[model samples]
Target chain A: MKISKEEVHYIAKLAKLHLTEEEADKMTEDFEKILSNFDAIRGVDVEGIMGETFKTTEAPHLRKDEERVFEDKKKLFQNTLDLKEGYIKVPKIIE
Target chain B: MTITIDAIKSAIEGGERLTEEIILQFYKRIEEREPEVNGFLTLCRDEALERARSIDQKRKKGEKLGRLAGVPVAIKDNISTDGMKTTCASRMLEDYIPPYDATVIKKLWDEDAIIIGKTNMDEFAMGSSNENSAFKVTSNPWDTKRVPGGSSGGSAAVVAAEMSVMSLGSDTGGSIRQPAAFCGVVGLKPTYGLVSRFGLIAFASSLDQIGPITRTVKDSAISLEVLQGHDPMDSTSYKGEASSYLESLEKGVKGLRMAVPKEFFHTKGLDPEIADSIRASIERYERLGAIVEEVSLPLMEESLAAYYLISSAEASSNLARFDGVRYGYRTKEYEKIEELMEKSRSEAFGKEVKRRIMMGTYALSSGYYDAYYNKAQKLRKIISLQYQEIFKDYDLIISPTTPILPFLKGEKTNDPLEMYLGDIYTININLAELPALSMPCGFSKEGLPIGLQLIGNHYSEATLLRAAHQLEQEIGLKSPIRKEEV
Candidate 1:
């Protein structure tokens, strides 16, 4: 269960994060300790238990799928980092 | 002594005190104690005064006032407030002013509650101790040297310090109850969907819930009345009748069936004082004619691992929205879109936030999904079924809110596993998605407050509040802030 720096780097990359060498080293140790403790779960016999995906106390009652006007459209657009012509500007994706 | 919400409401109604004067008095206390406690992240002094004056004017005109008329209430940084910053105590949302109010905030306004300020919390509600906050650490009101249990630390601290009449806090695992226990106030986490989570900043959406932190059980019950209900905005909001928590407050715990899970008493690292306090509280319930029994929830041993895996997995997916997108912080240096997102997240998120994301990513990764995520899912069912069986025969369950006393700052920051293990007592309740609360039972020899948790079945907030109110009367453990005044 000892996680390596390489694995930490791999996980960080998937999580859209980059770690310094020091942070990766510390994270590797943390993963090792936490995963070792989590080994306790390995012994539990969940033999006939069904895995739960979505947990809700009651069934979700969906609202009507109708569009409604947002009165404060201007304020909504103003919070964006960059707004150009009513579109949120971001790093260009097109080549 | 700290002024209770009941006192303020009656004073306003009886023409003895103006709401404005009461709000100003709370601000005076905040000015005195906030520097040392670090509870508030943003203050709304001018707006609070204006609202208080309007409330007074309405009373003068003989108009109907809201339940919380003129009461100044603090909100956790994660809950959105219209035109106010909801930072989640992370640098990413440091300056993010939400355009719309959260459903709970809107409900508070409708009830005539004054918005005092947004309080601090752990970054994205990640850590157990308030030290993980990117801005500053919130100290325990009882003892400034000890850490305030978090990520609802600021909400609990402000109420305990008499800075606000009540505060809203979100609990993913034990955020609300743990901090309330440490700060010696009352905290209640209602049944998962009983309260709307429309604008609560998502941590683990499935497990996350917003609850109240208050100075007394009665105050906690009243706040829940104002906060809970079905909201069209939140699809998962409970579509049932909201119970009258206040009407049942004085019903007492007589003839109630209470269960003390055997495993909780023997949890490793549990402080002896906390254990004694919880046991003593159970005895008090028995003395008041409660039929106390010992029950076994053997699956409890596996709860912490299940909680961490499931919550972290959910958090990893939910937090992916924070990638230098339409809002929040963006890195200044980035060439490509991917680089923009990666750099922005890495630069803005704190250490604990990154750690959880990594853990979650690792758990949900292709190769290890079954061993970690799926296994945790199955364990969740087994654990919840165990509680379902117990609740069928018992009216309530009791345990220590936190296994150990609040530790000093930096004590467990280096060892995240240790901090995670301390949550053993409270994490399972979230897995079951039941209502539970924490109220001060007694104080340790060092004068640190100790709390005992009372748990109830789904949507049984009225029952839980009734039992807790009775215990509050029996134990009569006043707020540590009041002790200071005495």
Candidate 2:
């Protein structure tokens, strides 16, 4: 419940969000209040209950394994912020 | 009087009013009122008119019309609209136009429902009020100074203001119902998996379901009929047969066993007027020969904590795809790919969204997973089972849609926990994967609308709508919001 600014920054880093010092301070306060509220779940007695996974009352329907090409490749790629040679341009990750 | 979807259909089919004329009339209203309400993020007036013209031509050619012919609908910004900007009211996707339509959008088009525009919402459906929208704050139609409970705030506001007869909104944790309650209209969060989530901008994927906001229960039923069905595109889409919601809507709630959860009434900060209104509505059900009982839901206390953890965790995962490389906004300055993603997300996402992602990241972090995320999931199962146990004996559960009436704008903006606590009555339904709806029950002393919620078992939309329809007829609090000429 008592989330420190360092912990807040670490989480933000994991989430790929950059936070300024001021924002980190504010988020730390917000998280402490919210997590303290969330801390109420810790006292819950889940002795016999299973943690929910992908279980449904009815069997989920699986679609037929078929491949169809999307017709609008031009429109699809148009949303790319930077497109060159039909590939999205990004800062080199492996260099 | 409000123009129901049925009225619109009849008038258009009977040639009393042209589809084009109906579209134009609503557009005129939108032009007059939308500036003040800020309900719409984007308006497609020309395309809507073009669609209306085509529908009219089909009618003139003696072709059979779709069920919702000539009806105009506003969509929440989160739902995909091919070629139309679907911003999610976030700076992140400010210019993003989806290349393909959402399953629900395609269904709307099939029904001949004209898509007038995209309505505003909380950025990524993260906030309880529309104030979180990056572009503008959507004002409540009843009281402009008050917040329209959100993240479907604009979807509810447009219908309440009669700018659109119906709208589609997504509910993760009462996003659709709460806003509808605040705006004095009908909002239904259909049973999860009952409606396809394909092309919905994901926010807590398991909990999120698309539903309708409308002026009448009948309209909500009809909208659900169009929106609900199996979609091969979404793997989680329900394969089970959905009931004919509109057909069974008039059957009434006679002999139906209803449960009033005692915990909902006892929640802190529940307005006395709203509680009285909910109790009065329950009495109306009893008067209609329905057996109503007060039951205990012991797990209700921890629902908020569990819901927040689960939703935020799923959101953090789902939203990870929003890096600057593909679509959406990109930061101008970033030397490394890592910096690019971090900077873009931090620059574009609103305060609440960042907080959620951070919280989720922490919960799912190495050491805390068992303590936080896993615990929340366990709590979710327990809470969900508690509802299932209650439903074994009761056909419906009734509660206040919102514990408090709509508050003034910026009143709770600084306090996230305060906003989260207001959702106590509505979040548990999402966790339980049940269908629930909010309809205007009465008005408070200040003349703001108070909402009563009716909840039903999974995929039981027909029963939920039927009971709401019956009560709508008996407790006729007609036009609780101030009706401006539109």
Candidate 3:
């Protein structure tokens, strides 16, 4: 249940979040309380039950594999924070 | 003219009130109260008025009208709105406007339901208290300083405050139900997959089901009639044949076998008044000729921990799409793409969101997955099976919707665990993928509202709403918050 500040930063990194020194300290404390609550699950014994990934009952519907003709691409491109001529712009990849 | 859905619909059809006039009337009331309650994030006044005018014109031209013709409804910010800002109450997507409508939004429009605005909520639908909203904390209309329970706080608050007639809210662990309980309104979390999740801003995918928050149970049933069904866009959308919720709404609880979970009654932090009110509600059902009995949920204690693990794990995955490239806020000063993502997320996400993400990532991390996430999943199966057994003997399960009454704005904001414990009663239903409805049962000694929850098996929304409507008719606590007119 106890999480160190270093571990908090590591998990935040995995979540693509960068915590400040203050945030990390506070998060470590929050984690202690939260994980302790989550620790209650440890008391539950699951010897026979299968792990239920019970997400959805609906089977994924398959569509015809044929390709469709092109439509205007403006809607998809509109939300991009940065875009160029018919392409999305991202930070430079190579030196 | 009355503001209730049934009354309004009749008035619109009777020519007693035009759709445009109805829109303007609600807008006038909303504008009067928005400054105090902070219920709305964005108001689509012009667009809503235009829609209303069109509906009136259509009816005048002998055109067939939709069931919800000219009724105005608010949507939680997390549900997508085409050409309107869908902020999710996060700085992360503060300026983001979705290009396509969410499946529910399209359905609402098809029914001629007017979209007035988006209601504020906890960031990414994460927190129990509305204070976690990055923009502004929404206040309970009943008490200006108290919270409307979250992450659908504003959605519920608006209905309670009479800012809107009804609203759409997504429930992941009692977000919609608790807020509706606090605000003294009717809220329903339909069976998981009963409604489409096509364009919902995903929080915990498996648990997150979009439902209606309304002033009356009948309105909620009608709203569900429009909101439920299969959609190809959302792979998990239920494919069952659609049925009208109106069919069984007036069917009272006479001879209905109801179970009151005794284990949930006197648990820690439960307000004594709230507990007594729920007991009284059960007694009322008995007086109405229903069979009520006390039952037990042995695995009730393990629900919260398992809920957090699964929900946070799903949230961590669902929220990963908020990187700089596709949409939403991007860091202005990151040289590398990874840095851009990290900084954007860190800056954009609020405290509760960050905590959940970290918790999820830790549980899902290599060494801990089996111990935490996997254990929780097995517990989920156990809990689901136990609920299935209970439903075989009982038509519905009843309990206090939340352990505590609506707290003051900053009371539990500092302690995440305390805020989380508020969801103890409501979370297990989501885990079991059952339909649960919360309606105003009574008020505390101090006059804040308390909710009684009625839960039913999968695809049992009709039964839950029927019980809620029956209770609503007998228990005549019409929100005292609306006592003072705008």
Q: Any residue pairs clashing in model 1, and if so which?
A: none
Q: Can you write out model 2's per-residue Cα lDDT over B1-486, one digit (the tens) per residue? A: 568888889888998889998899999888888988999999999999999999999999999999899999999999999999999999999999899999999999998999999999999999989999999999998989999889999999999888999999999999999999999999999888889999999999889999999999999999998999989998888888867887787897789999998888888899999999999998999999999999998766588888998899999999999988799999999899998998999899999999888888888999999998898888888777788899999999999999989999999999999999889899998988889999998999899999999999987788999999999989774663455432
Clash totals for all candidate models: 0, 0, 0
Worst 10 residues of 2 chain B by lDDT: B477-486
Task: Look at candidate 1 and tell me the lDDT of residue B119.
Answer: 95
Q: List the residue pairs that clash in candidate 3.
A: none
Q: Which regions of candidate 3 deviate over 4 angstroms? A: A53-72, B481-486
Q: What's the DockQ for every one of the candidates?
A: 0.71, 0.71, 0.67
Query: Chain A TM-scores, all candidates?
Result: 0.86, 0.87, 0.79
Which tens-of-lDDT digit does each residue in B1-486 have in candidate 3?
A: 225778777778878889998899889888788899998999999999999999999889878778788888999999999899999999989998887899999999998899999999999999987898999999999898899999999999999988788899999999989999999999999998889988999999889999999888889888999999888777777888987878798887899999887789758888999989998998999999899988888766688899989999998888889987778988889889898888888888888888888889999999999999999999998888888889999999999999998999888888888888899999999988888999999998899999999999988777888888899889875654444321
- Of 1 and 2, the candidate ahead on DockQ is 2
Q: What is the two-chain DockQ of model 1?
A: 0.71
What TM-score does candidate 2 get on C-alpha atoms? 0.98
Docking class of 1: medium
TM-score of candidate 3 on Cα atoms, chains taken together: 0.97
**Model 1: chain A TM-score against the true structure:** 0.86
